[model samples]
Target: MDGAGSGVWNDGSVHVDDQVGQGVSADLAAFLRNADDDRPVKIVSSVCGECGGRVFVVLVDDVEGGAERVCTGCGGRAFIADSAEFWGEADPGEAGCPCGGGEFETAVTFSLAADGPVRWVTVGLRCEQDGLCGIYVDWKIDYGPTDHLLALA
Candidate 1:
């Protein structure tokens, strides 16, 4: 239950199964690109007076989108976007990249997990920024409702 609210799951369970099938290639490609690169990316904090929480991932190849939700009042991690009752946070930068910042050297780990005969895929992300800062992004997917949009900022 520790990562339950960190964009790691949709069905309130630890297992997520959405990144399978044809989409797996793209997801894996993105993951690999993120893991192999060492570049400084910007993460827009929801509680940092930027209106809402917007997560932006940067790598040596390209930039991708990410999201993080927390309880509006308590600041506790909110598993579902609707569960938090607050969605005002929006990105103020250009298409997936921050406004004005030089890309710094950074490296990240992108992992995928699948279980049983279903071969479901869940993405786990950990990044090191400029060899000084470090953070992780954990996420899960649900195939029942295949409209998962955690990667969208």
Candidate 2:
């Protein structure tokens, strides 16, 4: 979970460790591994802050929208808005899915500093209609505002 040696993937995909946590599917992992060089990127946290859970449900409505990560164990939640200063991108929802689907399922991961705050975050999206998965977006937290970004998990 250390930040060192992170964000170095040759592909733009974010690295997700399914062994440390559960819920990420093999197909989703494969899609992330082979992500296009130009695709968006982000990490996965090993433990939940509330109730010590290891499972979470993620949601991403649009590129210009915020995302939510909810802990299944205790119903704890974290939210982040895409309008945050760290994110500078247009809304990708206007383009819709390549298959013309408008809905998507989301997955999120984070790179944590060994002894500090969160260093990075990656959000992944899967098309509800076609099962296609890819990076939705990612951000680098240089200022170490873990609570602001994670909402204290």
In order, candidate lDDTs are 0.26, 0.48
lDDT, residue 47, candidate 1: 28
**Tens digit per residue, CA lDDT, model 1, 78-130:** 32212122224323121121223322111122223222221122222222122
* Candidate 2 residue runs with Cα over 4 Å from true position: 1-21, 33-78, 81-95, 114-116, 145-153
Write one digit per residue (lDDT tens) for candidate 2, span 58-85: 5444544445555556877655433344
Q: Which stretches of candidate 1 lie over 4 Å from their true place?
A: 1-135, 148-151
Distance from true location, Cα of 85 in model 2, Å: 7.1
TM-score of 2: 0.47
Which RMSD does model 1 reach against the true structure? 15.1
